[model samples]
Target: MMKSIIDILIYAHDGRGLGHVSRSVAIGLAVRRLFPHLSVLLVTGCGATAELIGEGELDWIKLPSYKTKISCGKSCGDLGPSNIDDKVLGTVRAESLSDLVDVYKPKVILADHTPQGKHKELLRAVEGSTDSKWVLGVRAVVGDVDKVWSELSADTFTSRYSDILWYGDSSVTGSSELDKLSKHFQKIPFETGYVSRFKELRNIVTDVCTHKKLAGVVSIPWSGEGTSVLLEKVAEVLGGFDISEGIWKVYMNHRDPRVCGVKKSFECHPNVYLEQLGPSFLTDLANSRSAIIYGGYNSLTDVMGAGVPSVVLLRGMKDGEQEEHAAILSKSSSAIVNVFPEDEVTVEALRNSLEKCLKTKVEPSNMVLNGAANAARYLAELAGVRDANG
Candidate 1:
């Protein structure tokens, strides 16, 4: 007898950072690993993310990419009320998404954070679909609860849709916030843990200081957002240091290079090396003296897993969720200088922070790394598949 196939739709909102898209990819990979026969469709709106998701084990659909504006978890960049054009774009994106659902007819629809398309139309489409299990894939730290609740409550989307809200972070890491949100929504609230999708390169040295040479790996996207400014500041500060004595490796992972134009001269430094994106991002983190990073949960988790101390730069204009994550990691002695980009993000401050982080000893927190795989296993169970370890 032929085995039954499970079709899954993974929707990623591409309005802000690449976190949602990356996490969705990781989930799809996890699901595929659990059930080899499962057909996974990844629907995203980022061109760069689409490139990263090229010709994989899963099918792909690209929607209209929108600029993400995160203010206390209420996205307003391209999807919110701020943009006049997003109204048309949102409708178009929603119609395309609905069309995909209609044609593919997935057994399960997994929406990451926000529902795709317009509020009313998307809900209607999902509701009218035939026997589809709707799951809300949420990260551990969403944002300020009051702000998110107020925004979501006012929106028609929240009132019409219901889902099995699956959290992608450990309860230990996000218990406080998740507990608060649980009061309002009927959520399943399973801990999917922190999914670090970087390939575990074999023969790779897990130790950062193993290599005699000292290098700095700065991983941030080249967007005009606060992260880019932080990256430039770090480069400026690091340039003042005597790099002739040690290697300085800076790795940026975004399409736009103009954002880093201020430090264009550093690209030519004998000791300083610049790369657009590293396929082995985690490996580089493992090999570097320290990393300068924006506050994204995946990068933070990976650095912590590698036991590398880092300087976390929080986006100034966005919600304080990243700052919250940075604080937790810092409390565990895993990070240094958790501050907003606009406040005291100067060259002197960055240099001082980097010096401290490089000298500081950060013990890897197995709490998150171990929990991630277990979370994947739990998700498998939810999908009615037997756990491989079980």
Candidate 2:
């Protein structure tokens, strides 16, 4: 029997954070909704892929946990501390991708973030495959511009990728640098606004949350080893508020027990309701009076899209991506107040920032929020999938 052809195969390397996998799932879900006839498959290293994309929505291949570490400015991603060496792991993942392409024979392959994937494992898959349009999807504020320029301009990326997708608003994220780079390389990316999963996420939380409205929402998207101090400071600041009347809600992340200083049983504030992080987190935030959230691309875009006034807490990554995003958001939208220098975030500073944010009126950005759909549409076009009604 002949093997079934996959309409689209999306790959995401989630070494750094949930951003890559989240984007991939969002795009994959969008493709399913917009073009139901076409089949989509996801290949990712993130264990959270199943939870994010939901079961049975799309068939996916979970690759070996591949992570990247930059030391002395030269580092290819590898499965750290595993029994298998980096070279062996790379070869295994490369071979798996090659086999998937050979058997499934996808018409379009969408790669998120890294063009050639970690350690160039995806290069083999691309080279080994034929008649498939390979595209690269980049988010806004990709760390340093010089480093990104170097990666994008390399012969490897310039030669393989037929097109690029920019998942952000130009006015808000400042796409000029990337725009210039793409133009110089003659492979301009399709600006598809910010890819948001607000609706999808909201649906996930609705069953658990009984209330149709919430007064306020606070989200901390980080946890584990290095996050204790920051979490403590946040707890201290938020503890001062009076939530005895149940007017304020704190959506704490229970996904990891070592979620810093905030414990599930610890209630520092009166009348405050604490719950685990759910899909409803963003949905509730969108309907709340004010919000305090981590300054990630997805979080910021979702909040800004809903026109929710918010205080953005930056993790202060070494790459300065969050800081750059905060800076751009502060200038483009007046509804957000950003607290920088993650380590230096004090109770007073965070408290004052949130207070200020509460006073500001919500001013939603005018940028289109259908990036996932737009990206899916582009894939369909490339694959020659079209609506019968048209």
Candidate 3:
């Protein structure tokens, strides 16, 4: 039997935040809408990928997953309790990706964030598929400059990508970092200006700040060892506000096994309410009086694009991307306040920031927010789909 041809294949090795998978799904949905005749397949390692895809919107494949963490100043993989060797799992993911390429023979393949995919698994597949146009989709701030340039300068992987898509604006906070990358790479990438579900968040919302008196918004969808502590601090700080003020809304990932413990330990404040992370997260953020968010790309995109005054808690990852992003944005925008590690969070500081945020006047941002549609159009053109429409 013959395998069906796939018009577009998108791969996102997302094991942490919803950024990669969210961006991938947004582009896939946009492509499907713009070119109804085309078939789109999203291949990702995130278990939540399925939840993000709307019914009959796009086909998806979920691969075995592994999480990356920082330990002893070096990045390492956590395979959970599985006895399978880390290398063996890597091989399995690699082979699975290669098999999809060999069988489906997609006209175009898009690899998100990591150019060569997680553990360099997608490199072999890209090298073997001579007929497909393999593209790389990058976020606004990709950690260290030297490290990123060193990785992209490699001929083996750099030569394999036919096009590069940047999901950020050069005019934003991290423009200088992006400038360094462009100068080093010597190739101007197509700027998509912060890929988001703009039609879903920025454009469609006529009711801005429906919760004007609402204290703030907090979202930590991926739980960890310190998740409970963070939640406590949020409650403590928000609860400190006058009771007459509206409630503090928090969004969490109930699906994470660790979250149950976090929920149980949570001493819910009378003014704080917890809700599971859902499609309404961005919309809620847009309508919020203020937001307390981690320093992730999508979080920054939503907060900045919505012009919501926010307090960004830097994650201090090994790559220093989040810290770097928060630092840059702190310098560029007064609407944002940067706080350090979760272990040192002080209620006074958070309260002050929240107060400042509430007082600040923020107009909806004028930045380009139609990156998903822009990316879809570019991908369609790259695939030579002339009949594609807006």
Candidate number of the best TM-score: 3
Q: Candidate 1 at residue 109, lDDT?
A: 72
lDDT of 1 by residue, 146-216 (tens): 43355553252344445534444443454676675565454546665566554322112334344625556
Q: Higher lDDT: candidate 1 or 3?
A: 3
Lowest summed lDDT window (length 10), candidate 2:
203-212
Regions of candidate 1 where Cα sits further than 4 Å from its true position: 1-6, 50-58, 69-75, 78-84, 115-121, 145-174, 199-214, 225-232, 253-257, 333-343, 370-372, 387-389
lDDT-best of 1 and 2? 2
Number of the top-ranking candidate, with lDDT as the measure: 3
Screening candidate 1 with a backbone cut-off below 3 angstroms (N, C-alpha, C), the clashing residue pairs are: 15-68
State model 3's lDDT: 0.73
Computed on alpha carbons, the lDDT of every model, listed in order, comes to: 0.60, 0.70, 0.73
How many steric overlaps are in each model, in order? 1, 4, 0
- What is the TM-score of each predicted model, taking all chains together? 0.81, 0.84, 0.87
Ranking by TM-score: 3, 2, 1
Q: What lDDT does candidate 3 reach at residue 315?
A: 57
